[model samples]
Target: MSHYYDEHDLSRFGDMGRNAPDLWDKFNDWYQATFQEGSLTGREKALIALGVAHALQCPYCIDAWSQECLEKGSNLDQMTEAVHIAAAIRGGAALVHGVQMRKRNAQLSM
Candidate 1:
């Protein structure tokens, strides 16, 4: 099926650099540094990326990080838990926004 987001297009993510090289170079440098093995192991970082990918609902990132997680040595269980953590944080953020609704309702009632 032809979807709006083509899987092949993921490979072209850097194509924007053709138009603006400086911004692209800065972004690429940041990305490379961010993924380096630092305080967190590469596997741990991949799992975190997988979780954020799900939270952001980016198909390309999900696909890429799923493979990266495996290649970095994180197992299914670890990745699954990472996704759950993202879900919990996302759900909590949504729930917290309800406080605004509650405050507005109280003002209207008064």
Candidate 2:
């Protein structure tokens, strides 16, 4: 079945370079540097990217990172765990903000 987001869009990601070569070059450089071997292994970085992509709700990133994680040798369990970690952090952040709402409610009631 077709969806609003075509899988083909992923292939067109680099087309942005056509309009703005300088910014695109900088972005590409940053992206390449980010994925290079740092303190984290490539597989670990892929897993982290998968988690952040899921949390950000970017379908393109999610799709790309899912494949990347697999290609980087992350197993299903590890990828799933990374997604779950993102979910937990997102949930906790939402819940924590409720404290401010609760405090405002108390002040308004008084």
Best by TM-score: 2
Tens-place lDDT digits, model 1, residues 1-110: 66699999899998989999999999999999999999999888999999999999999999999999999888899999999999999999999999999999999995
TM-score of every model versus the real structure: 0.92, 0.94
Question: In model 1, what is the error at residue 65, expressed in angstroms?
Answer: 0.6
lDDT against the true structure, each candidate: 0.95, 0.95
Q: 1-110, model 2: which lDDT tens digit per residue?
A: 47788889999999999989999999999999999989999999999999999999999999999999989899999999999999999999999999999999999996
User: Which residue window of length 10 is worst by lDDT in model 1?
Assistant: 1-10
Clashing pairs in 2: none
TM-score of 1: 0.92
